[model samples]
Target: MSDRTPNPPSSQSRRLYQMTRGALIILPLSIAVVPWGILAGSLAVEAGLFDFQAQAVSALVFAGSVQLVGMGLIKAGATLSTLLLTTLFLTSRHLLYSATMRTRISHLPLHQRLLLGFLLTDELFAVSSHQTRKEFDFWYAFGAGFSFYLVWQLASLSGIVLGQSIPDLDQYGLDFAVAATFIAIVLPSVKKLSVLVTVIIALLLSVLFSVQGIEGGIILSSLIAMTIGYAISIVRKEPL
Candidate 1:
């Protein structure tokens, strides 16, 4: 036998490394999300919701925009049917995320696929879909997703508990954190002119929607932009 020794890390060392790296990576990312959670929590309190109820919604629904819209509707005294319809419209983007992910994650068992689908939020999808390692596995994605979910719920709960004690966030420019994080995550994926055009169109539409007082501006803008982008691709005979 050859005299070479294996260089594998010990189990304890690997666990420590994963935990440390996960914390380091996740903490900053979690900070970026804190503002949105704070806004959600503040709004929940303003809507006459209890802390527990707000926390429950954050934990269960787990979609930021949808949660915000739902809270808004509740505050407006919207009927159940209106609330349900608004939520469906707001969350319809998940269908696209699910369809795209199915091709990548289809080899997994039914239960695993179902669980993954439930955990698939915008941030989780952004991180997991772009993983390039040959050894990357569903467990890694799951770990990231679970960690994010926990952090988000905790942040929202803290915000609810500490609502108003937090100073004027708008004056402090906290809202930019989410957009900055999104840009950081998405910039790497723009490999073609078509993709660039799609992003630009989406941003423009988002601005226009905001100007026009459209509710759920980002979602509406993204849907319109994606549709237009696909149409442009078809006209130009470009592959998606």
Candidate 2:
């Protein structure tokens, strides 16, 4: 036998490895989020927010969909109460994300849990959920989330600065990049029949409700889709 024994990786090195792995795994989606972040910042500026205020919204709110909707509401002269209620409704989806992740993160300390909650974006959720429980690590999640956060901040700043110069930035349809990226990410994981069926039905329902001009139609469709998906999974005795 050889006399030399290999040294184990140090804690710091291990943490760095996990963090780097997470960030790399999330890089594609993070890149997709850049245009969405820029759109949010530009919309904020167009809605009459100062550059600093627009950046503040991005840094503080950090929810792309909500920030977009909130800016639309602001442009429409929505009341404060209406904006607040809409924000609450839009963000309610995070509750589901939290519940789904609770089992994985329950053992973490309070501060870590809080930080995780704060950093939990839809993209991060999708990335983390794809990992098996055995592969999940807090540092991994943090690396992914923090990197996305930094990207969003920089993207938003770019938009704020450039928005003033661009005559019609929204006309370029930048949001399509965000949608396309999410579709690519989600499609790979829809290997299960139940998931496939649920996604189809959800798409149909969302389109039908939106076409009908139903209030909160997208949210309603999501709730119904989740319920149906759960029932189908139970009936089929398959994991979802």
Model 2 misplaced stretches (Cα beyond 4 Å): 1-9, 165-192, 210-218, 238-240
Give the winner by TM-score.
Answer: 2
Per-candidate local distance difference test: 0.74, 0.84
The residue ranges of model 1 lying beyond 4 angstroms of the native Cα positions read 1-27, 131-136, 163-167, 231-240
By lDDT, the best candidate is 2
The clash numbers for all candidates, in the given order, read 0, 0
Query: Which residue pairs does candidate 2 place in steric collision?
Result: none
Task: Write the residue-wise lDDT of candidate 2 on 113-209 in tens digits.
Answer: 9888889998788778766776778999999888989999998998898785533545656556557766877789888777887788889998999
lDDT digits (tens) for residues 138-240 of candidate 1 = 6656666677777788778877988766546677575576577678777888876667888999989889889999877876788778888788778888865
